[model samples]
Target chain A: MADIILNPYYMQIASFILINIILGISIYITLSTGLLSLGSAGFMSIGAYTSALVTMKLGFPMPLGIVSGAMVAALAGILVGIPTLRLSGVYLAIATLGFGEVIRVWFNNLEITRGALGIPGIPQMGREITGSLREFGITPDMLGLRANQFSALILFFILLILVILTVWFFVRLQRSRIGRAYAAIKADEEAAEAMGINTTYYKVLAFAQGALVAGFAGALYAHTTSFINPGDFSYHRAVEILIFAVFGGSEVIWGPIFGAAFLTLMPEVLRGLADYRFMIYGVLLIVMMAFRPQGIIDYQVLDWLKKKVKRNKSASPLDKQKGGDA
Target chain B: MKKWMKVVGLIVSVMLLLSVVACGSQGTSGEGGEQSGETESGEKVAKIGVISYLTGDGAAYGEAITSGFEMARDELNEKHKGELKIELVIEDSAGKRDQALNAAQKLINSDNVLAILGPTLSSEMFVVGPEANAAGVPIMGTSNTAKGIPEIGDYVFRNSIPESLAIPAALKKAVDEFGIQKVAIIYGSDDDFTVSGYEVMKKAAEDLGLEILTTEEYATGDTDFSAQLTNIQAAEPDAILASSLYKEGGLIVDQARKMGLDVPFVGGNGFNSPQFINQAGEAANNLVVASPWFPERDDAQVKEFVAKFEEKYGKQPDQFAAQAYDALYIMAQAILDAGTVTDRDAVRDALANIKDFDGVTGDFSFDEIGDPVMEPVVLIVKDGKFVEFK
Candidate 1:
């Protein structure tokens, strides 16, 4: 296990899985609020191109570039969400998909984005961190590692923190007043509105938050991969993210994370199959849907697991007392 | 509910177990006998990696290229006999950049291949080429012709000629002979290859004192070119220059001809394949293209390669296959010259220093940046075939 973890090849795969998990969670946020906005890839593209340009063109610090990327995407998300959130279900999905295509086409024609040639040679985050550390009196020999040697590890830790914070945020939101309002809107928008909940605001809020998360993921992806192109963020990518959310059980917060990680790792693990990997992957997905259509994890399964743990805890003392009496 | 969950669990576990067994069997059958293949001279076997899109939109190119690699591998093994046996570890990239990166990483780290042959497309190359260069693994691109590919690093090399060299040669020849005074251009704006090709054509056209009437663009996978053709026809230029892949290029030509625009059409490297002619049929009659390889050349090496490739693959080899076939032989020659495939740096230096190496395309040498300096041929479609334009 240590050997596997230490391998740079596996590290690259692990980093990729982390990035996809972030993207999955982005779409999951919107699905949880009952709006299937298929526009995370657009926000991601905005984030990637913005952060890349900020770093490469302006020579800004990496953290600032990433933050600005998320902020810009959030702004764009709200701008799009204000008018489009009125539509529901497939209508909203189609609108968001159109928005995604518009963004890609804009990137393709924009001179600042270098048109279709794409902007290459974006600086990696690992290199910037190491350079700062070295300037602060850390010896290179003491570190005993190259810039990219620790890149995947740094990305892993960053993703770990982001995931933990995101999960915590969603759990807290599920219990808060806004969270209940979102739940009511998702259950029945007209009923929720009659019950004095502002469905429009909450739905739009959900879209904006989802965009924010996706944009942040895109920023990280750009810095990690050191390359960005319009083709990288297309309708196909958006659909893939939706699949991650749906396949993992969007009803629960953990579903999209599991879905993203599992799907991303599946192809890498099946490397031995050569060209037949995708066929086997399709077969497995079909089987999975046939068996557990709701998803691998859902709210009901979580509730059942909670009950099982509680029963075991409550029954332990009773069994102990009976044994003593006997 | 509980029964259903249990059944589902059982099925999932069974499928996973089956796959694990399949992987185990393949590993044992493929690489398990490497130890016993060593000769009395204590020379170890050489392992080379091939990465290409075996099953996707670009799979046709991948199929042809891999076939070429296999043909060359078989011939090398037969020629060398017991001295050195080349073991190929092939991986599929599916024409995606991330998949290509993963394939390259696995090839370099796990398979431990001395060198990698291809990742098929230029977009894939832009992402994985640097990764291989950083890992100190030499990668030779067979079909990557976009600009800045060889500029990826010192460890990167390509046998395919870039549009910068190929486009100018063909454009100059067309203008000088055909007397094309004014020209209109159309290209796939979304793709790096077509975009770069358009850039080269634009510069070359201006350099040759040709008037640029208008320029039009379309996305890849778009079959309808009637609108773009009508717009270009309004310009009424002496000729039309198109920078597109074979499929769309053919459609553009057919549509333009059907619209009664009877001017000559000059194309970039993307139309080099015979598929362009096959798809456009008689409409491709006057279409001229710039390419690095023409199988009909009267050369012994070219004849043998064309015959062997046709015999093996049951189809005429395109420029993509020709380059791939040449790439494998070049790698073999470099290894033989270096006398050790285990030393990657030695092989890279030897590969860079190759001079006047004869290939099916042309006799070329690697420049300082590891790009091939080969002459691009001007070919025209006549009588449903590609022949020298002259």
Candidate 2:
């Protein structure tokens, strides 16, 4: 029990932190644009299997395999997004959810994807393809640090930084012309379109960007877990991510991130209520929706805090002037 | 306050309290030997944790595993009169890795189970393994057959076979003993069980210097294999090894015969279900697989168990059932050997020390890792039932 909080075995779940974080941020990206996409899990599977296959079959380097996996997922995202650009709100969610299922079933039936009996010993990049290369007769240097603790944490922060950077870019985008176009489109698509804004192009870009994050996250996920199967990317998972987005608050950049972390840790927190965990989860979700629809905190709090600080600083100057005049 | 808000607050508080109680399974009964918690010393009363995929895709197989464990508990309790007490705490896993982890944790933390059995999928075990190990509890996966030790470090045990041993041995028997050549390989690609089968089968074929006529894949729940059969026939393989779980395996064999591919198909432990032939009807005959335990494996203990299972269930015990019965008995044996119900480390070591502990599956021995050494049964499908073959 003492070691339950941190065990070498926990490295798997911890490594997955990057996956959830990336997924959360990706969902955040879509939520920021006043759109929601539930197809990240599907895109992840595409990336995971594609990356895993290339690494295992072609014996490619780990980085290339992961990148290829992301590229493949991104490509599929664009392909799906091109035709579904006009759809939004629940319709978009449904379309993306269906799209995910179709992709899952396709992977399930495909000869290379291996159907139900998923591929085993999936050549987890760190597990098989390492610096040692003993099997390849090219022992450059073994990834001799036995436990993947450092790498797992490192990968997590690296992904966290990427999410931060993406958000920073999103912040910039929200202030830019394209960002204005998106805001206008979100406020009213027809009104923005009347003003000559290309809603379809911006919407497509939003879908593609969301998918790129999902794909990149998926690649990282494949390498970290070293295994992937059709089961991992079921439609239910996509819905779960959507829940994360909605629960955390759809309108904020950090909403999805919080949602992902909250849900991931929720099971553990609710461990005492073992039998009724899911029931409680449902009730809690309804409660949150009915009450705190804006989430635990919103971005306006930041602005309020910023203004309060500025007011105090400016008040100091006025006080000094008043004292000198007296 | 809004009536809904109060209701929500009450619900949240109750949920929090329940969780606290659940995690309280870690509560030790002090030096009193747990006498305070029971109804009475003479009254039969003990709690056991049963973790499984009771509600997900693995539910069908997981149900069998739990029932098997329950069956053993019933027998033990009834046989010992009221002196031996037992209660089963059954938890459903959604088959997600995280769900498995939570279920297992709740079982250990809240239920105060002496030991847990199941979580039939390898992926679940991979995720839940560490927590069980950290908590110093024993978790036995009755049906997962993936390679390598569980992610829970080393405290976990599985009464299953890995592909590295089972697949090659079965294929060799097909080629060398049966004099079969030019085999076709059809398996599920998306599952680790089936995909591992492909890699092992391919390697074994290449090593044995046997030629593969064609290789094929099937999707889960896809009943038709006529397309794969067409490709198989074109190559003219003498035999086929269709690696899939029971549902699709049965259909593949049935469809193969319907399509006129009469070659004898070898299967893995995935073939060890009575439903396979029952579902396929007469088409199931002549199909063979490397089973974990043979009905006629010449083990008297297994024979006795099967006699009872047959009488009770009105069906022959499949490999999963047999493995389940044996897994519980072996776990109980480890507990008794450890001589203390409270210490998890002692029980784990006692489990590790198991050697030649005979049960239905064969001698239950543990290597450094907690994998049981069970006999591999090669059975041929005959008249919609498995027949043990040399």
Which one is best on lDDT? 1
- Per-residue accuracy of model 2 over A36-124 as CA lDDT, tens digit each: 78888888788888887888899888778878887888788889998876687889888888888888888777787666545544544
Per-residue lDDT value at A126 in model 1:
52
lDDT of 2 by residue, B1-390 (tens): 256456545755864775566556424221222421235555534455777776545667776677678788788767655444556677667567656655665566545667778777777666556556645677887887776645345678887776666777777777766788688889887677777677777888889888887788776678777888889988888888888888998888888888888878888767777777778888988787777777776667777888888787777776677788888777777766776556767877888888887777776677677766666766777777777766
Candidate 1, residues B1-390, lDDT tens digits: the string is 688668657976976896686678558645753632356776557788899999778888899899888888898889886677787888889988788888887777767788999999888888788778866888999998888989989999999999989888888888888889999999999987899899999999999999999999999999998888888999999999999989999999999989999888889888888788889998998788888898889899999988888787788888888888889889988888888868889889989988888878889789999999888888888878889988
* Ten-residue region with minimum lDDT total, candidate 2 chain B: B28-37
Model 2 interface CAPRI class? incorrect
What range of 10 consecutive residues in model 1 chain B has the weakest lDDT sum?
B29-38
State which candidate has the highest TM-score: 1
Q: Candidate 1 residues A1-326, lDDT tens each?
A: 85565456777788788889889888987887889899999999999999999998998888899989988999999999999998889999999999999999999999999788887777766556656777998744565654445554566667677767877888898899988887888788899999988788888888898999899989988887777889999999999998898788888878898889889988877777777788878887888788778778887678777998999977899878888899
At residue B92, what lDDT does model 1 achieve?
A: 87
Candidate 1 residue A10 C-alpha distance from true site, Å: 1.3
Ten-residue segment with the worst summed lDDT in candidate 1 chain A?
A145-154
